[model samples]
Target: MPVQRIFFGWPVPAMPPRRIAVLLGSIALFAVITLVFTLPNSIPSGPSLGRFTDHKISLPKLPKTFSSPSILSPFRVAAHPPPVLKNTTSGDSKWYSNWNWLSPFSSSVTLDENRSLLPPLNERPPIYTYYDHTQKKAADLKAADNALLLTWRRAWWAQGFQPIILSPAEALNNPLYAELQTLELDSTLKVELSRWLAWENMGTGILCNYLVFPMGAQEDHLLSFLRRGKYPKLTRFENLGHGIFVGSKAEITAAVKTALDNPELKTAKDFISTVPKETFQVDPHHESVAYYDPVVVKNKYPKIDEAISKGANGLEILNKLIISHLHGTWRNRFSKGIAVLKPEPDHMSAAIEPAFTLAEFLAQCPESPMPSSCPPNRPKCSPCMASTPLKISTPPTYRNTSELYTIGTVPHPFTMAVLSSFRDNIDVPWIRRESSRDPWITALTKEVSGTGVSSAPRIIKFKEAVASEHGTFHTLWLTAEKEVPQDLDWRFGFTIPRNATDTGKSETPVPGPERRPQPKPDPKNGPVANPDDVKKERELLKRAKDFGQARTPAEEKLRGAIEAWNLADTEAWRFARAFLARSRVERLKWEEEEKHYVGGAGAERGKSSGWGRWFDD
Candidate 1:
């Protein structure tokens, strides 16, 4: 009966197998399509993805052995010949066997035996020799050797040459030559040897035998030796003159000129030439004429001609000419001669001494009577006209003349006399103290204090008079009259009265007492006082009464305001205003005190009235 409701269940429908088969087929197809598209797109491509085409050319094969003739056939294996073994019978066999067959065509060839392989004795290396063609010829082979040995010895004595050594037997036979020949030299020796050869046209090998050591035969021995060490002589020639061995005359001249161009060589030449002829003879024939000739030419100018003209006998003239030539002029020679002469005494002193004393030497000699010859002026003559011969006392000998002269001239007798006179007369008395005298007593008495007119006498006279009359020495006193006391009574006693008092302090009258104030008259009786006047009077009275009150409302308010202010504020402003008002009142009281009071009032009364009014109002 209660709204019967019907609930129905919907039945589940079964799916068709064909439709399911269709869906499955479609999904399968979709998946296959997706996989096909994605797999190809997602996969990464590699380096070997593209096909490679290499076009390499193949090389032909080489054969192991070669044929004898054809160039290509030589590389073929089949046509090659077999190796043959070398025979060991002769020396050549060992040589052939030792020869590197692998390097068959090498440039070098070794020989097993030295003697058999060498050339015949006739074809041996030549022996070089050098001969000296000097003025002193060699007497024999040993003598020639000795000369060469001496040259070598001299070379050794010079710088850059080394010592030579030899065996005792070797040293004994033509010792110097043997020693030279037996020398063992280094690369430096070889270079020096080469230089000597180039310089003297000597054989380098001969020089080497004498200067350097014996070495085994080497190909290009000379060239190798030269290469190892520097021949600075050659280098210097190449750099500064013509290259080695200046052969031509022009070349030799050029080389000489180039050498002269060097400042050191030129300076050396100048120095050598300046050397004396005696000095040139030091090394005998080996003297450097290159250094001496130019200097001699320069210095021996006119003298050279003079010497020729005079031959050897005109010695004085020749000497003068030589001196003139050396110095270039006669004046220069004269100047040098003057320098050589010892300096004369100073002319000033010499002239003064001759004028005054004549003991000092005169620098200039007197002219000779003949004008051709004169002796120098002698200081031996006496200066004083005294007929006695002058005795010149010589000072003790000194190491030098200047010292002697100094001691002799200074401290002269006249100078010492002047100094002694000055010391005794002028300087002695200036150092003593003076005497004192009584000035006051002498002056008061008006008498001459002493026999002479000394300053003490005068001062005493003056002081004596002043002290006697005035009790003090500084009192006033007349020159001619007697001194008197300086008092008013004494000066004016006769003209003025002596017994009178001053009378300047007279007694003043005493003031009367002050009268009482009268009462005010009725206002109506006084000539009918006007209303305005009455009003004015009333107003004035009112004002006075108001002033008389302690304070008006406004004044009180102002006072209250002042009182309300802090003490600090009062100190800043209000206290000052109040103090000023009180001071004005006090000032008025003081003024009244100073004045004469009118009527029956004294100064004190006026002051009291003023003070009372000021405070009451």
Candidate 2:
């Protein structure tokens, strides 16, 4: 045996020097391979494909009065309550319960078998009235009811109210919004009839008049009788908006000053432009005077006048003194002196006339689809006598005035306990029509949906308001130019109503603010760049952005190494030498590191590098 030694389980026979060198090299290579597999050192995920390319990337504000967020926002989204089903009890009211469209009269749903569904938004409940599929009449609403709802939604419109305009007129350099509605209400609730009455001692053709209905025991009896399929109204009295007007002493004084200063002012638009939007709800910074604060002013105004008043804000004094303006004295200023700009005759014929008779509608019965089953053939019954009686339809007004008028059920804060105790008995459901908008007017006018301008409007010109006995030939209404002004602030509900679209086909309505049109880009901000440049810039930006978001030093190093390796074929020598040097170093380290596996952890501390490993202690 030529110089043999047993260093491990097998006998290591000393070979020739060349063979020994080869065996040593092979051992070192195996250790390097083992270290590559066994060591914790890692080169991330993408670049280590033996080198090449690796790159990649990756308010809780509710609108309006719904200001607060839900408690469950941190976890799962809170389940929205289900919509009211027909004939269901009131307890199951859901988020969309207020969305009473497509449901049977929700008013039929009773609270504790006594109350009606016609309560405040907070107190209203699910509808219990079922419309049987077989009942064709139930399936189809009386055209009059549709017309009434249509009209009711527009009840507050008048030339004197704040004018909400969609487009500018060619006549004058018209402001987009006409100061139309009187922000300073000049009428009191105590008056049953209007102070602006157009009649000779009779409240006929009143502008900006309240549509009062019988309240208290009278309202209950009528509503109860209505539930039993009876008359629409027991009394001739009807519900209305506050027969409101737009003047106060300050308003009148400023307007007189503006008028006196500018003799050329002829049109309402000119007068309106001069009135400040700060006087009303149009100012976003504050709300309309709180409903109750007016009372406190009445009791305390006298006491303040009793003393030499300090620098008490005059604005508050005017706000308080403004209360007296609600009397008849204030209304005379508008009705007698001012000439109003009004729409041409409103299409009230449909609302004023009954579309069908009781027997006529009932004739839609499967047994009788013939004309004989309709009106004329059947004995005429009063429109008010039918189940879907000619309910109080709203009189025609302008496209909802710019004023902060809501066309909901009347006398919200009931003055009498009778009106307040309405929930004590079963009454009709809250009408789906709150006068927010009229779908019929929408359909009839063929208004371009998003644009406020009517595409096929019947009336083109606005006529001046005429006195009651003046044998009026025309009615004044708002007119608009085809082009909507770009800079003008449009009013009305900024929040798109989450109701079903007029297109009847969509089942699920989206919930959120309606999307506004993209504003035209300003050239001053930045000129439009070439697409190719944009794309190149974007790519460069992506590279730069990576440094901030995700790229690590190790990753950058690995990426650089990969790029170098991939480009090595053309300029190979430097990279080849560098890689070989690193490989050799790694190989030498692993050779001694492998001894730790064979001889255990203690041996690692004792191992050496280069030729020193041959003398490990």
Candidate 3:
């Protein structure tokens, strides 16, 4: 008999089966091993687009661990019960019962008040107020009888998004108004400069209409200033803690009147003043601050009432009609993607103002000198015309999803304000917190199971297998960024006990309403060995969620410590389960590959022209 060869601590068997399994297993294990890397979720994933689009990665079937809490639970705190005082002497062994307040484990955690990335409270952006101005040549203003009409620029005449108003000081200091006094102002400069003076935040309103809801709540206030507050009934309402609101003029007016006239409409003294009244007048007399009487003008003009009398249900619809008529309904969500919004000059400035607002644009540059002719308080160009709309490019899956959806027919603003611009005051975390846990778990499980896996760790590996595809989707939608680099990596985030877990098996049945027979417990594939432990985990996660939704400061501190403990425990759990899954998956995969190879080429190779065959020949 030939002496068996020893190689790398493994006896190279003369027999085919043992040697074949060992050889393939080693090769497969070496192939599957990879170095682990962790990164912050906020790290931008942009810089690669086409690569993800070209080659689609296949998602693995996730394990049952990825199920909804009703089916399976991973790791999460479900409810945060206030630690009730309990007697350790009672035979009960719940975690909260063994309270030694001085014990390090029982110590509470606190959020760092100094940890906020938000700007200082005193440094909030100034609430913008628009100045009222008149339409037609400066000479034509003297002919308009209604002083409110004098301040008003009729919808057909103004090309910008909303109505314009100017202040008393602004009337004197602004160079645009001073230029209106000049006799030689060219027809073009006259139009451009003249349009510049007629500023209203209509573009901002159109933008508000574009968001799904309260995202535009603050800017929506600017609309009240539009047209010198002619629509007092429409503009003066309290938008307290309810969802976003849209209604006919009568509805909003009634709501506002009740809030102002009746005390009951007030909820939580949170309502700041939002009375609607004119802020400017079109002096029939040549440029003078003395003629600015908003009350006298409004009582005479009453533009909103006139519109309603003409069958315009309310000011919102009136404004919305103008917007939709001029620009299409862009509020409907289109497929998500990359778009570069370039600002276009509004009709008012098309003949007069350059595509870029020279004064405002130049002022942005470092050490750039302002033109002597421009006023100390130079007027801003229209947000609608000057803003470049965010022309975004959608990824493959998101692209096809919106194919059947309708969008605005009118052209998009060349330069449109981005959602970020409106929400600059908001701050996000260094480690962004998870948004919706259920959706993410569902997504991961579906991929891991392919159709179903028995364990959580396998589901995770399956997640890694299709990282590029699903990872990209999560990064994009999760971070709220438009695109991320093709190679971008992501991890889960937590909000409180300094962080954030999961457990459970399905209690429900399918169509017949009968419970499916439970598979016999196998050491290799059975229910979790400790059922109580899973229940405890589920309870802890529920508590963490409660802490996350904590409205007050006291409850929030306990939540942080709980979150940290949960996260640490979860990671530890994942490591153990994942290691097991990795070993199992590797072994199974290797066996499969080995079987295929041996039955085809490897088996023949391992047979090695045996001496028997030689002798037979």
Candidate 4:
């Protein structure tokens, strides 16, 4: 036989089956040992959006030194429990906890303090505006405006509304944006067109049946006016002064479709005019301010026009103004210190007051000796950080919390809001209460699991119906029931600690979560790990493993409940993606058919079939 030459580690000649098998076995054994030893130190995976349910659930190998605690044993706690942190100002820690860090829910009692800032879900109107960074003039104008955009957002946020700031780049996602790109319209006209197109995109696609408004950047709606419902309600299409128009989803979408059909309507203003108006009903009067020269209005209000005719001063004219559209002309006068408009004390709420006064903002400018840092007395630095609280009165309806059946509609905002609030907050690195359980957790788990049934259904049986011709259903739920417990027990154990904290410096660290100290760098020996520290870490890891291995009756129940809801929630997201993807494909197909009918020889036949009848089907 020819002498076999070794290339690297293996012989050049093919090894015997027995030898190869033995080598593979040895490698596998080593991997198993390494994984077992390192698993305790490994971090749990973060939350993922898609393909959550289909993935295989693997149980992590227990550490070599891990001692399985008794089923009745309690969780291991720190030797010394950290002192309960107190608020000196309030003298009660309960009030601090009530803030519900970044959560969208609040108690009915604290509604005014928390949920008062933003309108509750279904009530919050989207204030749409456009910005063009490509234009030098517009860029310079916005840049020099000194936090005008920030102030504008705060103004809306204060009134419980979130403004949607769109740009030409953002509009690229809209299918209609392609048409805008094809046309070479005037830059100014294009800005207007792009804004409407983007708004139409949002109204039709995301927020169906929702009312949306387009407002100028410089324009500000009085908080009092909005609270009092003074803003114009459009039955068809009504201009609410200062070029602001509010319309329903159908009306706006119809207008945009008309624009796309008619090539003559090039400008955004033209699209607004295309919006169907009620011929019978008269247009409402829109208030305008003539505080300074060159006052412009969409429809003149008797009060404002009369004041201007009587030669009313800045303050007098300002009082009568409901929505102040301080465009370039008004802003220019302010910049040159030519015009001054001030409101009375009672009218303060009625005016478009920013989070901070202009004087306070100016004091903290870069030119000041002590800049960049907020003044000790002033807390205006971190504006718009308040959470948009949930409307407790409107709990998730039965449709959303219905389990065992697919609803085809997404989970209610209330259900989502509750999930967002409690998911992170309630995760404590401690044992479940032996006596009583949290009502919120019990309710939420049920809601989420039920919601998942509708939102994320296991459509494996019906795969052929919903599945695209080319691709099969993306992800199906895990078939085996045993996998759930193993996955939850091995992955999260008892609880995944919340290591994050709020912005307040004086606030105490989140209780129960331990932070490991990093190894210090030495001059001669480079980074050196302390043997004692390493030993301590191993002990802690062992203790943690023990705590997880041994679960109380309550803990065991809690773990199972958590696993059930979590799996359902994961599946819900997975199903939603597959469902939406299928819908998109169907939409594209319909659009193709529509194009063929519109442009092809079958135009008359398609019209006879009925416009948009296919979509309804």
Give the CA lDDT, 0 to 100, for residue 69 in model 4: 50
Model 1 vs. true fold: TM: 0.15
True-vs-predicted CA distance for residue 454, candidate 4, Å: 48
Error of 3 at 438 (Å): 11
Clashes (N, CA, C under 3 Å) per candidate: 18, 21, 73, 4
The RMSD (Cα, Å) of candidate 1 is 62.3
Q: 1-617, model 2: which lDDT tens digit per residue?
A: 45567877789756788988998999999999989897755655554543454753322556655543454346646454334444222221121223332112222232221112221212111101011112233212323222222121121111111111111111112221122122222233101111211111211111122111111111134222322322221111111122122333334334334433343333223223334444322212111111112233234344433321432333233322222121111111222111121111121111111111111221111111121211111123121111221122122232223111111111011101111122212112221222122222332223223337542222111100111111111111111101111111011101111121132233334563245333343332122333454444334433333432454676455434332322211111121122223223333343354333212211213222232221234
* TM per candidate: 0.15, 0.15, 0.21, 0.27
Cα RMSD of all models vs. native, in order, equals 62.3, 38.1, 33.3, 29.1
Candidate 4 on 477-579: residue-level lDDT in tens?
A: 2111101111111111011111221323343356723353454553321223245543443344333334345668865564555433443332332233333
Q: Which candidate gets the maximum lDDT versus the true structure?
A: 4
Candidate 1 structure quality by residue, lDDT tens digits, 1-617: 33343447554455577989999999999999999989987877865433464654568876744533454654545433222232222211121222232221111223222101111111111112222223243234334333333333222211112212122222133213332234344444323332332333311111222311111111124323332332322221111111112132233223333433344432332222322333211212211001112233234334434443443333333222222121121111112111100011111121112111212111112111111211111112212121222222222111111111111111111111122222212111221221122222222123334334544334333322222211111111111011111121111111111122223343434452234334344321122233354444334433333332466675555434332322121111211122222223333443354243111111122122121221122
Residue 130 Cα positional deviation in candidate 3, in Å, after optimal superposition: 7.4
Question: How much is 557 displaced in model 4, in angstroms?
Answer: 37
By lDDT, rank the candidates, best first: 4, 3, 1, 2
lDDT of 3 by residue, 1-617 (tens): 77888999899757777888999999877666532233445457887565769686778988766755744554554444443332211111112322221122222211221111111111111111222223333422322222222112222112112212322333334433553455343354333323223222111111111111111111223322331323322222222111112223343334333323433322323222222233112112111001112232134325534543444243332233222212211111222313111112111111111111211221121110111111111122122221233233211111112212211001101101111022111112311352221222222234334434333443244223222222212222211111111111001100001100011245465575446665454332112223454344334333333433433664444334333423322222222222222223323343355343212211112222222221121
lDDT of 1: 0.25
Rank order (by TM-score, best first): 4, 3, 2, 1
